[model samples]
Target chain A: MNRLFVFCEGPDDIRFFEGVLKSELREGYASVELIAYAGMKHIRVDGFIRGIGAMGDDYLMVADIDSDRTVKAKKNRLKRWYRELDTDKVIIVIKEIEGWYLAGLNDHASRSLGLRPLPGTDRITKERFNRMIPDHYVSRIDLMIEIIKRYSIKVAREKNRSFRFFYWKCLE
Target chain B: MRIKQVSCRNFKSFSDLTVDLDEYNILIGTNAAGKTNFIRIFRFFRDIARHGLGNAISLQGGAEYIRNIRISSDVPTEIGIIFENELGVFSGVRDTRGGSHTLSFHQIEYRFSLQIEEGGYRILEDFLRISCSCTPDLGEGESGQGELRITHTEDGVFYELSTPEGIAIEITEIIPPYLQKNVPRSGTLLIENPLLVPMPGFQRFFAEIAIYDFDPRTPRKAIPLSGRSDLEEDGSNLAIVLKGILADPEKKRRLSNLMTELLPFVQDIDVRKFMDSSIYFTVTERYGDEHPLPSSVISDGTVNVINLICALYFDEKPFIVIEEPEKNVHPYLIARVVSMFGDAARNKQILITTHNPGVVRHADIEDILLISRDSAGYSIITKPARREEVRTFLKNEVGIEELYIQNLLGL
Candidate 1:
């Protein structure tokens, strides 16, 4: 199995990709060893990317839209960002990671929290979504992991175009 | 007596993190990244010196918390520290432990591997040895820093003594009797023994080391206490220490003068007789113009600063491990404290763990040990100056603190 370094935003992103995503991706592909490169260090991203590239491990990444909605717009605006960071594959979560979590929220999980099922295509507002979470300190990724397990990948893909493309890329 | 390097195995968050020590060290990391645990490694030794091994292990949640959960080893947890003896050369290498010497300084290395059993943790191998330096204590016996070696066995149960003229092994005769008499507060038996007095190289080095942590609440309690030169973990002796310093006209004046620099108050520090014969103080305002501040009523920051200043001045503990000097003080005040520690480190080796950016920014890059948790949830430590990229950045910049404020310290 190849040693794949999956670069994500934070510990939460790492937990989602490594703990949940990899657990579901174990059908045929080699397990990925996730490395969370918090883009907070914006100036040193290129240096860190270059350092990881020199490590010989294939780099896969996921970045949040943070502000921009389109990937091309983000790339155009963040021209100074290390665009060549991804060696194998890369994807962006629209608006923020909450949209991906909302896309994967099933009825049972939504009802468990006294909430109705969210439309697969709907963009999640951080304020509205965080209202359902009673404990703020608990890992939002772990909570999403439980909800995503029962989520229809087909429905999530249909609602979230970016997540859908990323999901297909994972199988590929 | 400077700690050149330390390598720890199976310590919390660190499977193996070895880094060289600097005069002024700032151990910085995100919350729960085990910066405190890394500092505990030094505290563990201090506890052993103050209390025993059993008490030290129990204080930090026992051996289970100490052993790195990643390793399932049948062997014991290991920690090795190396320093240069007075006559040993600074090899700055792990392997050269009193083996080969080119300088007058004798290299000394102490390794302790503790194994936890049903009852308590057992110290496996802990011994101190110096590079061949013959002290003239052997009756005007031709002492010219010659090939006189004081080596201890791997079990720490024996000493392998060798001189340029002779060689002697003390497994049964001298070693057993001395160790039997020792109370075992530390891993090694080198505190203050007549046998060790013959060669003061290793003995003096270990004795000068001291660790302290002052609790702010201690100064608030009205307790009567006597002062000593060495300050306790909590500033329980705040009033007593003040009283002791106040007794000495020169030292008392110096304390008030230094306080003026750190804290601006036109008042004096007074210690009065409290209620009982315990650690408490009574703050009263009886004077007309000059309101003398008692230790109990002093602000938390003022008390902490006073304890720190007293520790630096009176306590001659060459190797001092202070937890967080940045506590209870303004950031600007903390910056002054950091510089004071920097000066203190010049005379005595000081290791500090802090969340203060003032310390990180003001301290030299070589002194910063940036600690971070890896993907496996283990802590890794690195000196920013040791890295070429960070060194390149520092070459162009005036402010290193901005590296941290900009969230670039993880490098």
Candidate 2:
């Protein structure tokens, strides 16, 4: 049986994805086990599979790409990283949540995308963007998901188009 | 195959010490007592000799100059690991504050001495002497500036040559097969101190020795719930390693069988990339249903176990080193896990460091390393006598936890 594994950086990512995306993955991943890892180093799921069980070709790693340094440097590092990758078994998602939040569409972005801000948030914000522009239209989470899907196809070469961005809940 | 002897000086907590290793060795020491440092010497020698001087020094916490000598004494510290090699006997020595020397088989010994000068420590004197077990000879009138004289000897004939000039002198040459590769590089001057010197010959020998630390830091995310080997440091290549294993059906079934033994609840693993290009590991249960065991849902213990099993079972041939194997694991499972390692380590040499008595009690005492510190500031690594001391202590009023806490076996 082929299993799909998901590793989220934090607990909130786990709860939000499992709670919201359950319906979409339910049938497609009938024999799949979904788990959320809190940190990068805490899990050795690949090593576990090597000895007794096998790891499926499908894997997803999610992390927040907050701040300018994270957005530019991390993505660049990940871009160069693709050269060494097999490109057929894994997908990496870098969320520019902070980029979306600071662009004047803070509350609507949060509510529409289901993104939970770091610790001190009381509730989803109702703030709205006063000015709409082409700059704002580009680089949204929805567009990011689409780009990731296309990028994955170039690398993984999987024929199935059923794959969805692990952080797709942000687009809801 | 076995460690014949270990001599240490001014290394960490040990000021000076020499200990022999028997078939069954025990190293007993108190907490903060340099026992770990004693075990670390093997790693130090293995790493330095295997990886080269640069890597060894870097791995041992690089500090530019490793002036590791006796704290209060003027005596330069030295450590020599004497072991039996296939050709014959060899002793690799490192003087933390002195020089690097090697005693090889063909009755030839190379010694490079260090002199602390204003610029930096320089090689004041170097010698390539011969010692044919029955006799020793220190060559006479050998004076040269910035040149390493290598003498290859064979059948009582010595052929000596200088580095840059390549001037050959007729001393006597018994050039064994190993000495053929002794080519000197002239442009860069090799450092005098052992810390900066490279041992090409020792490295050749050390490659046969394998050491696996099984560090929990081997990025857990790299382990696909269903995969073969692990990824590189950042676990970025996990996808590649997984795909390599999944391409074959026989190997996948082998993985399934092993998983059944370790994680009974794990029926199977399903891996896939969503249309978005993100990869995920989904686990199937014994029941028909399955779900993804998000990298987060798994516990640390499960991750560590999986890492160990993967490295042990997946690699071609391996030598394993484990630290605190009992961490995050249930006490009841310690015996079972140890037994599994014991069985797996049947053909491999295994070195483990642990504070868990459960781990110790479960294994044969012969494999236990009883490390402890003595009053002289030297770490004394000795096995517990066959006497009833350790056994009686285990059966006595104190439990394993208290025994360690009360400083019974030191550390």
Candidate 3:
């Protein structure tokens, strides 16, 4: 089994991988470990990856695309930042990590909040927790945990193309 | 004197980083990039040469502290150096329990390595060869090359050139013989071993390497008079060192001229012994009628610059390791010290760890070792590469000072 050193942009990205990827690609990333970074700003896309490659372990860096107009644009910018990266893969989540949760909005746990699914696969910012989710029982992130527990990988892929792309890239 | 290159594995902050050094190697790194740890390699060897293997390891907070945390204990902490062997100039006195012995050599290249064993440390590898410059004109025996190798394995330390093929046994007088059976725990006692009599000069060069962390506080203070063999680690006996320099009129004149160029305001410097029998320095200002200021009242820049000039000017160590000479020196004075370090490298090797922008600006890109750490905090030293982007950066007039500030010297 390949050991995965997953560098996440924030806690939510960590949760998404722990809650979702922990089951999706069991054999590929049997020993997936997550390191939480402050944000994309705090992620050193190059040195962080360069140093780990020679360890003979698979490495992945996941950061949200917020400042750049598109994921491709963000990847381009990172390419310039890194110039040359060996044996490490960089995968950018579209809009933000929260957009990943929008993929699972059709689940029964999410529907219990009586909130509609986020349309056009746009990012569901943290503010969306307070605006929606009436009669919320726990914290915003706790609710997100529940949402992920009941998340439908099939519906998520149908709702978000970038999410589907990212998922397949990891499995590959 | 010259270190062609050095490689380290599981040594301090460097998990695996090989650095090629120039005559004047200047290293600049961000905080916690382990630049100090990089220089510690030489200090580690120097400590071993001064004390022994056991004391040096303990002084560094034990073997675990010296080894990188990322590396497993099962893997030995390996450190090695490969340098151009300037063997003829070595002057080392080897002391043994039996007696002291002197040896001379003309070595071509020396590869010395040490590994931290489970219990302590051992000299695991050594390879030395005689210079090919030896020709028939000198002697028929000198025409070809001679090899000396000492290796430690599960059995014992093997003197490859010896008859018994081990350091534990002695050899005939036809060849340089082995004198001891014990394994060297701290460092290779190559000079003392008859097996390596022809390569003692290489080991002496290693013994002569100096690493300094000059403290501006207490060591610089007046203490009871004690004989100073060389500059103390803490800059103690600085006044005595200054007094010794003053004893030589030409050296004193050169220092005064350098200071005059560096600090134009300084008219003259006086080293005096007081009623308390302690020595101190006083600087006279060039400006009119102002009373000479004692070292106690002088600026930090004056004291630090003077100490550095005196220390570097006289010390004959082929390799001198200094940390942050830019500390407290005036901006203009920092440049002067930088120039002095550069000029001194003509005769010897100098490795300086610096964060000062002026020092960075003064360094040639090839001479600058840009150090950065991985997320796991292992040091990665970057040298100027032949990549097109680097070429563009070099041609675009972007000084290393600015490039480092921008964090663009990617490692």
Number of the top candidate by lDDT? Answer: 3
Candidate 2 per-residue lDDT, tens place, B216-326, comes to 444334333444354332233344444555667745654554454456567766556655455554455666456556544555665555555554444443334455555
* Interface RMSD for all numbered candidates: 19.7, 19.9, 27.1
DockQ of 2: 0.01
- How high is the lDDT of residue B301 in model 2? 65
Per-residue lDDT of B87-135 in model 3, one digit per residue for the tens?
5532222222222222223334444455566656665555454432322
Which candidate comes out best when scored by TM-score?
A: 3
Assess the local accuracy of residue A12 in candidate 1 as a C-alpha lDDT between 0 and 100.
Answer: 42
Q: How accurate is candidate 1 locally (lDDT)?
A: 0.62
The 0-to-1 C-alpha lDDT of every candidate, in the order given, reads 0.62, 0.42, 0.63
| TM-score between model 3 and native | 0.61
Q: A123-154 in candidate 2: lDDT tens per residue?
A: 11212211221232221222223222222212
Residue A75 accuracy (lDDT) in model 3: 74
